[model samples]
Structure formats: structure tokens, C-alpha cells
Target: MLLLKWSAMGDVVIATALFEDIAQAFPGREIHLNTLPVWEGLFVEDSRFSSVFAVDLRARQGQMQRIVEWLQRVRAGHYDLVIDLQCNDRSRLLLSLLWLVGCHIPYRLGNRRQFPYNIAPAELPKPVHTMTRCRAALEAGGISATTPRPVLSLPQFNHARVDRLMKAHELREGHYAVFMPGCNAKGYLKRWGAARYAALANRFHEDGLVRIVLIGGADEVDECQAIAETCGEWLVNLCGQTEIFDIPLLCQPARLIVANDTGGAHLASVSTTPMLVICGPTDPRRVKPLGDNVVTLQADLPCINCYRKTCSHHSCMSMLTPDRVWQRVQKLVQEAA
Candidate 1:
């Protein structure tokens, strides 16, 4: 079977869970996943798949050429089925190209119907987990999954890098909580206010229970710094310090993770660490972290779960106060202990 799921780190991680369910359901089938180049590292040593095809979607000049080449490669292997986990225009275009190249796959499955496609649509039984949505897609192709949850497995990285980070931040083992206070700058509405995160950090610091380690991309450095300034000396703002791959490692050793609805929250879900995820605009039921240990704090406002790119008012996020988040965090920490 051929599985297609492209970029956006959080979605990619969510797609991986579907792959896990597919692998479990069809142990003998050769599973090949198609994803963007940057996200290939996230699935480096995956034992479930026969191979992973990393496509560079950004290369404009050779776009059709590469598609033709990939089609030829897929046709030669004679895949029995094609699953478009990413039900977007690009995936539809790729599948159309595959058909044009005489690669007649019996079944093609996805979550949505957008293109003038001839594939069977997977119908979900109920409003289930995102991971279950993937499993439902596989079930549409006559595959049955025993496990409904997504599972992620990564390689053992050299601890030297983590040790260096710990030393630089003066972090004692089991004494710090990782705080990812920023989302994609483009989706500013998804981020909780920096001041509120600072207030939460200060509250945690006052209790002497946890030190906050700020984590995010270089673009988020300013916001992280702003929170650090408010929290004073206890906050270790490592916003621009680590690579994408280092995030899971950083979260793996943390006491807890307090993050917005971003890739960090997904990483925290994959780890054994307990996490308190603050949701805004996005529906917690649909997009929250896929784990039992996760606790999501979302505002009760009707405008929440809007899923809109532009909002007239961000009361959905603004209404989720520091105290509300702190209560959830405190509960998670207490339960974890």
C-alpha cells in the first residue's frame, strides 16, 4: 500500500499514528509512506514501513518530472492500493498523475472528497480520534486494526547534546517543566499570550516545584524572551537553541510539558511525560494530543473550535486565563507524582 501525508509537523505526526494502525492491521503488507523532505527525519528508523519516499514539494521546476518519475517507480512495484491520508489538492493531482501513467490501483482512500476522484471514501462510525480517522481509512480498504491509537518511536540520540543543554541551563534531573509558549508565527491566534505564560512560569517558580524551559523556533525567540523577562531568573529560554529533532529528547526528560496547540504538544504526547495542552480556536476533540495523560484547557466560548485562519476577535484564546491553565497543570503534576 502507498500512503501519502505531506508537511506541517503536527499533521505529519498525527498521520504517523494512522501508519501505525495500518501496520498493525496488515502485518504482511509492504507499507510505503510519502512525505516532504524535512519531515522524513521524523520517521527515519520506522520498522513498520518497507520504505519511505521523501518528496521535495518546494522544487518548482521539476515538479511534473518528479511526479512522473515517482509514478514510474510505483507502477513498476504494482502497489495493490493507494491511501491518500492527506486529502488535499496536491494529493489528488498526484493520484491523477498515477492513473495517467497506467498505474491502476484497485482502491484509493482518504478522509475527504475534493477532486473528481474515483476512490472510495472512508466513512467513520462516529466522531472518533484523529488516529482512528486513519484507521477508518485503512478499514475502507478491507484492513482491520486492533489498536486505534497512534504510536511514535524514535532512535536513541547521543545524550551528550541533552547533557550540554542541561549543564548550560543548570537544570537538575526531574526538576524542570518544558514550556512551549509559541505557535507558528503565521497562526498567532493559536498561541497563548506571552504575559499569561510568564504568569504561569512565575507561579510555578514561586512554588519551587518546577523551572520553566522555554522551547520554540527562532521566530519565537522574542516571545520566549518576553516571558523570560517577566518570570525573571528561573526561566531558561532555549527558544532558538535546539533543532527540530532535539524537541522530543528535551520533552522526554521533562517533569511535565505546558504548551499551546502546536508540534511541541504532539511531541509531548509521544513521550512518557504528562502534558497540559491549552487549546484555542481548534477543537480539542479533533486536534488535541493523542494520549490519555494529556489534559486540554480550552475556553467555553461558542467561538472556540472556529478553525478559522483570521478571527475578528481572539476571545477564544484570550478567555483561557492563566489560572485556568494553572489548575489543569497542577492537577496533571499531582496525578503524575
Candidate 2:
């Protein structure tokens, strides 16, 4: 079986959850995954996959020659089945190219094509979690999904690396809370203000119940600094300090994580950390992290879950006050304890 999904880190993580179901359902079948070059490291130690193909879609630069070359390489594999989890025009085009090459797989599973393709489309349930949706698609293709949680096993992460990070950050052992204050480029409004995060961090710090570690990408450095300024000496800014692959390991020591609707939030959920996800335009029901200990705080605004790209008035997140999130944090901390 060949699985095609590339880029957008969180979505890839969500898709990984269906691997166990696919493996169990097709025991002898070899599962090869096609993903972006950057994510190759993330799946290096994942035993669920037989091999990983790192496709450099960006470098192809819309060149027909490069596309054909890559397509030829993929067609050479003679896959028994092709599962298009990405479910976009590019993926559909690739599937079409595969069909043109006479690599006739008994089944080709993907979203309903907006245009047309050789294989019939499988319609997935709407407004459901992407992970669950992917699992459902696998089920449609005869795979039974058992593990609902996203699977991420990294053998490269050793205690020495963990200890080094801890020592570098002066992180104390025990129950700590992580504060993630940034989203990816798309979901800016989902993030709470730095002051609000600072207030929450101060509350946890003053209570001496939880140490707050701030994590985010380089774009979030300003927000991280702003929170640190208001948080005084209690906060540790790990934003831009660690690589994307290092985040799961960094979050391993934390008991609970408070984050925006971001990749880190999803990572925190898969790390066995109790998580409180602050959401805005995105619906908590649709995209919130899937785990027993995961909770979400969203304003009861009528316009919430709109999935808008830009909002002139972000009252949805603005109204989700720090106190409300603090209450949720308190609950999660208690549950963790």
C-alpha cells in the first residue's frame, strides 16, 4: 500500500493515527508513505511504515518533466493500493498520472475529486476530526482503526538529549505547565494575547504549583518576549530554541500544556500531557486535540467555528478571558495531579 500525504505538520501528525488500523487490517502488506522532505525525520523511527519517500514538491516548480520523472518513479513501485490522505488537486493529479501509467490498483481511496479521476471517490464524513476522517477512509478501504491517538515513536530521542535540553533550559523535574502562544501562519486569531498568557503564567507561578515553559516558532519570538517581560522571572522562553522535531521531547516533561490552536497543541496532546487548547475561529469539536485529558476553552460566540481566514473583529478569542482559561488550566492541573 502507498500512502500519499505531504506537508502541513499537524495534518500529517493527525494522519499518522490511522497507520495502526491499516497495519492490522493488512498484516502482510508493506505500507510506504510519501511525504515532504522536512517530515522525513519525524517518521524515521515509525515501525508502522515499511519505507518513506521524501518528495520535494516545491523543487519541481510546476515543471512537467520533473513531475513526470517523479510520477515514473512512483509508478515503478507497482503499488497494490494508493491512499490519498492529502485529498487536494495536486494529489488527485498524481493519482491520475498513476492511472495513466497503467498501474491499476484494485482500489484507490481519496476524497471526492472536484474534477475527475479514473478511480471512484470515497466521500468522508464532514465536520469531523481529520484524524477520525482519515481513519474512516481507511475503514472504507477495509482497514479497521483501533488506536485513535496519533502515533509518534522516535528512537533518536535518548535520555541524554532530554537531559541536555533540561539542563540547557534549567527545567525542574515534576509537574509543569507549557504555554504555547503561537499558531502557524494561517491561524493568527486563534492565539491569545501575550499579556493574557503572562497573567496565566504568573498565576501558576505564584501558586508554586506549575512551572511555565513557553514554546513556539521564530515568528512567535516577539510574543514570547512580551509574555516573558510581564511574567518577570518565572517564565522560560524556549521559542526559537528547539527544532520542530525536538518539541515532542521537550513537552515530555510537562504535565499539562496550555496552547493556541497550533501544531504544538496537537503535539502536546500526543505526548500524554493534559492539554487546554484555546481556540477562536476554528471549532473545538472539529480540530481540538483528541485525547482523554485534552480540554478546550472557546468563547460562546455565535460567529465561532467560522473557519475564516481573516477576522476584522476577533471577539471570539478576545472574549475567551484569561480567567476562564485559568479555570480550565486549574482543572487540568488538578486532574494531572
Candidate 3:
């Protein structure tokens, strides 16, 4: 079987429940996943997947040749089945090309559409969480996706890596809180502003409680740095220092994880750690991180969940003040105690 999830989508990346459902249904069958080259390391080490094909969609050297070669490889495999978790235009194009080349995959599933997958398209209702949608797709194939949450397999190497990162940052297990304030370029509007983050850090600092660790990608370094500057001794900016794989492992000991509607929160959700996801323009029902411990706080506003990448007025996020979020945090802390 071939499973194609060939993008750097964070939400899709953390959809572990769907993977579990497929694994359960297939049982002992070999599961081959196609993903981007950068994400190959994530699944290649796992025992659940038999093979990982790192497809490079952004081939600069031999673009057309690469596609032909990849398609030829697909033809050679003569896959009896295809599970398209990607469910995007690109995947559709590739699948159509393969069909044109006479690669007949009798069984195809995932996504709600019928073109690529004409047989038993998933009939899930709207206003559902990401896991629910993924589960419905698998359930159509007689797969039980009762497992609501996702999990990651941390290798022995990550233990040492975690130790190195933790030690370097003078962090103790379960003694700190992770603050993911910054988001990707695509989600610039999702940010709740640096001033707000600084103010929140100050509030926590005033109480003299858990240490604050601000983390993000290199793109977020400057933004996180601005917040850390105002935070002084209260916050430690480790935005550019950490890797994607490091987040789930590091979140194991977190007292709390407060994140924007980014992948970081989703990564942290798998753990028992308490997380508060700040939903601005994104719909909580559609993409809220999956876990009992994970809670989402969307502002009660008229224009909430606008689903726009850019907003003229980011009142959805800014309207919900840090004080309101702080109250939720205090309640979570009390409950944890």
C-alpha cells in the first residue's frame, strides 16, 4: 500500500490518530509513506512504517525528469492500494498522471472527494475536528480510529539530545512552561502580538513561578527575541535553537504549553502536559490539537475563525486580552495542583 502525505504541513504531520487507524486496519501489511525529504527522518525510524519514500516535489535540477522518474517508480510498484492522506490538488494531479500511465490501483481512500477515490468516499459531516475527519476516512475502509489522540516514538538519540538542550538552557524536567507566541509567515495574523506575550511573561515573573521558555523557528527568532528583551530574566528565548522533533520530547516535562494555532501546540498535545491553544482566525473545531489535556481558548467575538491568512484588523486575537488568557492559565495551574 502507498500512503502519500507529501507536504510540510504541521497539522497533517501531527495527525497521529489517522496513522494509528490505518496501521490497525492493515495489520501486518507493509505500509509505505511518501513525504517530503525533510520529513523523511520522522517516519523512517518508526517500526510501524515498512518504507519511507522521500519525494522531492521542489526539484530544481531535473524537474520534469524527476516527476517522470517518480511516476515510473510508482508504475513499477503496481500498488494494489493507495491511501492519500494528503488530499490536495498536487496529490490529485500526480494520481491522475499515474492513472494515465496505466497504474491501476483498485483501492483508494482518504479525503471526501470522488475523482481520485471513486470507491466509498468518506461521508463525514462538517464542523468536526481534524482527527475526526481523518478517522471518518479510515472508518470507511473498515478501520477503527477510536484512538482520539496521536503519539510519537522518541528514539534513544533524542534522550541525549534532550539532555543537551535542557542542560544548555538550564531547564529542569517539568519545572518550566513553553510559550509558542510566533508563527510561520503563512500564519502571521495568528500571533497575539509581542507586547502581549511580554506582558504575560511579566505576570508570571511577578509570581516567581515556573520558568518561561519561548521557542519557534529561525523565522521567529527576531520576534521571540523582542519578547525576551522585555521579559528580562523571566523568559529564555530558544526559538531558533530547537528542532521540530525536539518539541514533542521536550514537552514531556512541561508544566504548561501556551501556543498560537501553530504546529507546536499540536506537537505538545500528545503529551500529558496541559496546553492552552489560542485560536484567532483559525477554527478550533476543525484544527484544535487532540487530547483531553489540550484546551482551546478562542475569543468570543463576532469575527472569530475568519479562516483568513491576513486580516485588516486582528481583533480576533488582540480582542482577547492577555488577562483573560492568564485567568485560564491560573485555573489550569490550580487544577494541575
Candidate 4:
């Protein structure tokens, strides 16, 4: 069996829910995952997959050659089943290429009602959450999909690293809040502002959650730094200091995770910790992190969920005040306590 889900680290984290389901459905059969190079660390040590293939199909140079080579490798593997969870144009093209090369695989499951998919759900409605669509696709492919929650396996090395960081700061488990203050460059509009985050940190501190842990990639260093500088010694800015796999482990002991709608928020959902994902231009219904303890806060506006790249007013985010977010956080923190 071969599962294909490419870029966007958040979607990759959501797709991890299906790994165990696929493994159980096809016991003894080797399950292989094909993803981008950056996400290979997520599944390289996972026991569910026999092999993890990393390819950059979205590269500007040699993209076609890369796809052709990937197709060649797939053809050689002679996979019996191909699960296209991505359901994007590129993944559809990959499925079409299999037919073009006469590489026939028995089962090709996809979420959409499109060609090259021999198996698919009868009606996968649009505007649905990505995780729901993934579940439907698996069910259509005859997998029970009993496990619906996102999960990650923590490495002992990451465990030790997190322990050292927490000890250095004298932070206790389930006493600190994790903040993901930045998103990918393309989703800058989704940010709920660094000043608001700093205010929230102060509020959390006053309310007894003194230690605030800021986690993000290199793109978020400036944003995290701004929050740390404003919030003072309480904020531990671990931005760019940890790998993707370390997110879940760090989040495991956190009392609360407050974040913008970003990939790190989704990665942190693997932990059972209470998380609050602030939404702006993006719709929480379609993109919010998945977990029983996770909740989303979006301002009510006619222009909400506009999905706009460039906006004139930008009220979707600007109007979402820190006081409103703090109210929601109080509930999460109180409940978790």
C-alpha cells in the first residue's frame, strides 16, 4: 500500500491519524508513505510505515523530471493500493501518470469525485474539514478508521531535550502555556498580532500560568522575539530551536496552547493538552486543529472566512481583540485545571 500526501506540514500532521488505521486494515502488508523531504522526520521512526519516500514535486526546477522519476519508482514498487489523501491537482496527475504508463494498481482511493480514482466516497461535500475528508476516503477504501485523533510518537532524545529546557527554566509539567504566534509567510493575515499575544501572556501570568513557551519555525523568530521582549522573562521563545517532531513532546506537558491558525498548532494537537486556535481570514470549520480539547476563536463578521490573501480593512483579525481571546482562554485553563 502507498499513501501520498505532500506539502503543508499541518495537513501532514492531520493525515497521521490515518496511519494506524491503514496499518491495521492491511496487516502484514507493508505501508509506504510519500511526502516532501522536510516531513520525512515525522514518519522515519514510526513503526506503522515500512518505508518513507520524500520527493519535492513542487520544486521550480526539474519538477517534471522529479514527478517522472517518482512515478517510475512507484511503477517499480507495483503497489496494490494507492491512497490519494491530497486530492490536489498534482496528486491527481500522479494517478493519471500511472494509467499513462500502464501501471495498473487495483485500488486507488481519493476523497473527490474525479478520474483516476477507482475507489472514492459517493459524496465528499466541499467546505468540510480536511480530517473528515481523509476519514471518508479511508472508509471508502474499506478501512474502518477507528482512530480519528491526530497522534505522534515522541523520540527519547526529544524527551531529554524538552526535559532539559523545562528544567533550565524551572517550569513544571502542565503549568506553562505554549504559544504559536506565527504562520507561514503566505498566511500572514491569519496572525492575531504580536501585541495581542504579549497582552495575553501578561494575563496568563497574572492568572497564575506564569511560564509561557513560544514555539515556531525560523519564520516566526521575529514574531516570537517581539512577544518575549514585551512579556519579559516569563516567555521562553523556543522558536527555530526545535524540530517538527519535538512539538508534540513539548506540548504534552503544557497546560494550554494558544496559537494562530498555523502548522505548529496542528502538530501540537497530537497532545491531549487544551489548545485555543485563533482564526481570522481562514474558516475554523475547514482548517481548525483536531482534538477533543481543542477550540477555535474567530470574530463574528460578515467578511469572516473570506480566504482573501490581500484585504483592505483586515477587520477579520484586527477586530478580534485580546480581551475576547482571554475570555476563551480562561475557560480552557479553568477546565484543564
Candidate 5:
């Protein structure tokens, strides 16, 4: 069996629930996951997956050549079943190419009713959440995905790395807050302003919730840096220092995690730690982090959930005040306690 979940960190994290579902459905069967190279380390040590295959098909240079080579490898494996959890054009093309190469896998499953997929859900309603769509895809293949939630078990090396970070900062488990205040360049509208985050950090600081940690990828370094500067010594800016695999492990010990509608929030959702995700341009119904421990805050503006990459007014996020978010954060933290 081969499960495909490619690029975009948030979508991959949400699809992890199907990993266990497939593993349970077919006991003793070889289960392999194909994802981007950066995400390969996440499932390397996972017991449910027999192996993790990574290929960067996004690189325009030699992309076709890479696809041909990857297809050859797939054909050689002769996998009995191939599940397209990605359900995108790339995976669809891969499936189509598999047929073109005379590599006929018995079961080709996908979400939408289209070519190359012999099986799919009868009705995958419009504007559905990513997790729900992934679950419905798996269930359509006669697999039960009842327990739909993100789950991650990090390797010892990853845990040790986090231990060193916690010790170096003189931090204890469940005694600190993590703030993810940035998104990628294309999704800048999703950010809830660093100024508002600084104010929220000040609120947390005033309440004696010291040891606020700010984390993000290279794209988010400047945003996190600004927050750290405004909050002073209390904020530990670890932007660009942590790996994708380090997110869940780091969140496991945190008191709470506050993030924009970004991948970090989705990655942190697997942890039991309480989290709050601020949603603006994106629709929470379709993209919010999934878990009982996770909460999403969206402004009550008429233009909320516009799903627009660019906006003239930007009232959805600008109108969502820090004080309003802080109240919900306090309620969540207290409830978790």
C-alpha cells in the first residue's frame, strides 16, 4: 500500500490520521508514505509506515525527468493499492502516468470522482475541511477513519534536541507559551499583525506567564523578531532554528500555542497542548487546526472568511483586537488547567 501526501505542511499534518486508519485496516501489509523531502524525517521513525519516499517534483529543473524516475520506482514496487490523499493535479497526473506506463495497480483511490480513481466517495460536499475530505477518501476505500485527529510520535533524537532547547532556556514542561506569528510570503494576509501579538505577549507577561517562545520558519524570522523585540527578554525568538519535525515535540511541553492560520498551528494540533489559531482571510471551517485542544478566533466582520490573498481594506484581521483574542486564550488556558 502507498499513501500520497505532498507539499504544504498543514494539509500533510491533517492527513496523518489516515496513516493509522490504513494501518489498522490492513494489518501486516506494507504501508509506505510518499511526501516531500522536508517532511520525510517526520515519518522515518514511525512504526505504522514501512517506509517514507520523498521526491521534490516542484523543482522546475529536471521535474519531468524526476517524475519519470519516481514512476519507474513505483512500477517496480508493484504496490497493490495506491491512495491519493493529496487529491490534487500533481497526484492525478502521477496516477495517469502510472496507467500510461502500463503499471496497473489493483486499487487506485482518491477523493473526487475523476479519472484514474476506481473508488471515491459518492458525495464529497463543497467547502469541506481538509481533514474531512481526507477521511472521506479513506472511508470510501472501505477503511474506517472514525478517529480523525492528528497523531505524531517523534524519534528520540528529536526529543533530545528539544530537551537541550528547554534546558538551555531554563524552561520546564508545560510552563511556557509558544507564539507563531507569521505565514509564508503568499499568505501574508493570514497574519494577525505582529503589533497585536506584541500586545498579547505583554498581556501574558503581565499575568506572570513568562517564558514566551516565538517560533517560525525562515519566512517568518522578521515577524517573530519584531514580536521578541517588543516583548523584551521574556520572548525567546527561535525562528529558523527549529526543523519541521521539531514542532510537535516542542509543543508537547508548552502551556499554550498561539498562531496565525499557518502550518505551525496544524503541526502543533497533534499535541495535547492547548492552542489558539487566529483566522482572518482564510475560512476556519475549511482550514482551521483540528483537535479539541485547538480553538480558532475569527473577526465578526461581514468580510470575514473572504479567502482572498489580497484585500484593500484588510478589516477581517485588523478589526480582530488583541483583547478579544486574549479573553478566549485565558478561557482556553484555564479550561486546559
Candidate 6:
């Protein structure tokens, strides 16, 4: 059996739990996964996967070689079952090539009406979130309906690294709040302004008693740096420093995490860390992280859920002030206390 899912980091994080669901549905059958090179690190070491193969669509020559090699395995192994969780143009092309090579895969499962899929989502529900839709597809197509929690295991090397970061920054465990101020970096509309973040960081440092930590990727270095400077010595800027998988471990000690709709928020979904997700252009109903202690703050604009990256007005995010978020922050902290 082969399971295919090669997408964004957040999507992959959300799908991590569904491996257990598939494993439960098809017991005793070896489950092989096809994912990107970056994500190979997550499932290659995992016991759930019998084998893990990397598929880098970005690299042309490497992708062609891997495709040829994988087709050979498909022909030799005679894998009849292929679950196309990605259900995109890439997976469709792979299936088409397999047919061209005379690899007769008997059972093809997917959510869309693409060719070669014998099983697919049958009358799936609407208004459900993105991950929930994936779950529904699994249930409708005979996979077990159990909702497994997303899990990301940290490597042994990261513990010492995180310890050093804490020591260098003088951060105490469970006494700090993490702020993720950067969005996808492709657009300015998706983020709550860094000015707002600076205000919140300064406010939290002064009154909330919890230390403030500004964390983001290289794309957000400038934003994190400006915010860190504005918030003074109390706020530490660790943007572009920590790895994506290490965010969960960092969040483990966080009193609370406040983030714009970003990858770190999705990475933190596996942990019990309380998170406040600020959503604007993208709909939270479709992509917010699935976790026990997560809350979303969205502007009450009419065009809030519009997925457009570039907007002229941009009030969907600009109107959603820091004070509004701070109110919710206070409420979440009190409820947790």
C-alpha cells in the first residue's frame, strides 16, 4: 500500500495524525509513504511507515529519477492499493505515467474525480475545515474514522540546542509567551502589523509577568528584529534561528503562544500549548490548527474569508487591533489559570 501526501509544512503537520487512522483501517498491511525531501525526515524514522520515499517536485532531474525508480518498485512489488491524499496534478501525473509503463494498480483511492481512482469521497460534507475534509475522505473511503492527534518527535540533538537557547536568553520554563508575527511573506495582508505585535510584547512584558519571545523564519527576520527592539530587553528575537520541528519543543515551555496564521502555529498544534491564532485573508475555519487549547481571532469584516493575497483596502487585518487580541489573550490566560 502506498500513501501520497507532499504539500506544505502545515498541511503535512495536520496529516501526521491521519497515518494512525489509516494504519488502524488496514492492519497488517505495510504502509509506504511518498512525500517531499524535507518531510522525509518526519516519516522516514517513524515506525508507522514500512518505507519512506522522497519526491521533490521542485527539482526536475532528481524528480524524474525518483519517479523512474519508484515505478520500478511499483512494478516489482505490484502495489495494488494507492491512496492519493495529495489528490493534485502531481499525483495524477504519476498515476498516468504508471499506466503508460503498464503498472496495473488495482485500487486507487482519492478525494477527487481524477482518473484511476476506484474509491473517493462520496457525498462529503461542506463547511468543514481542510484537515477535517481529509478526515472525512478517509472515513467515506473505508479508512478508520478515528481522530488521532498530530505527533512530531524531536531529535535528541535539539534538547541541548533548546537548553542553550533558554540559557543564553535567560528564559525560564513555562514563564514566557511566544509571538509569531510573520505570515507567508508573500503578502502583507495576511499579517497583523508588527507595530501591533510590538505593542502587545511591550504590554505583556510590563503587566503579564510572562517573558516575551519573538519567533519567526528568515522571511520574518526584519519584522522580528524591529519588534524585539521595540519591546526592549524583555523580548528575545529567535527568528530564523530555530528549526521548524523545534517550535513544538519551544512551545512546550511557553505560557502562551500568539501567532498570525503561520507554520509555527500549525507545528504547535500537536502540543498542549495554548495558542491564539490571528487570521485575516485566509479563513480560519479551513486551516486553523487542530489542538485542544487553541483559539482564533478574526476581523468582523464582510470579506474576512476571502482568500485573496493582495487587497487594496486590507481592512480585514488592519481593523483587527492589538487591543481586541489582547482582550482575548487575557480571557484565555484567565481560563487556563
Local accuracy by lDDT, each model: 0.77, 0.76, 0.78, 0.86, 0.86, 0.80
Alpha carbon deviation, residue 298, candidate 3 (Å): 1.6
Give lDDT: candidate 6, residue 46. Answer: 74
Clashing pairs in 1: none
Off by over 4 Å in 1: 58-62, 112-122, 125-129, 142-150, 308-313
Please report how far candidate 3 places residue 149 from its true position, in Å.
Answer: 2.7
Model 6 C-alpha lDDT per residue in residues 189-279, reported as the tens digit of each score: 7788889999888777777555788888878998888787777777888899998667887888888899988877888777777789998
lDDT per residue for candidate 5 within 7-110, as digits (tens), equals: 68788888887787888899999988889987887787789887888888888899889898789878878899999998889889989999988999999999
TM-score of each: 0.86, 0.90, 0.90, 0.95, 0.94, 0.90
What digit string (tens of lDDT, one per residue) describes model 3 on residues 1-337?
A: 8888765556556566677777877789988777788778777577778887876877688878878877987777778888887777877888888888788788887667677785444566778765666666777777777866666667778778988988887788767888999888777988888888888888876776558998898768877989988877747788888776788778878778889988777777767788888888888887778877778888888888888877787988887788999899888867876
lDDT of 2: 0.76
Q: What's the distance in Å from true for residue 336, model 4?
A: 4.5
Against the true structure, what is every candidate's RMSD?
Answer: 3.0, 2.6, 2.4, 1.5, 1.8, 2.4
Instruction: List ranges where model 3 is wrong by over 4 Å.
Output: 58-63, 118-122, 333-337
- Per-residue alpha-carbon lDDT of model 1 for 222-289, expressed as tens digits? 88988988777778888988866567778777888899988877866767688888888887877787
Task: Judging by TM-score against the true structure, name the best candidate.
Answer: 4
Error of 1 at 336 (Å): 4.1
Error of 2 at 63 (Å): 3.7
Where is model 4 more than 4 Å wrong at Cα? none
The residue pairs that clash in candidate 4, if any, are none
What lDDT score is found at residue 191 in candidate 4? 89
The predicted structure with the larger lDDT, 3 or 4, is: 4
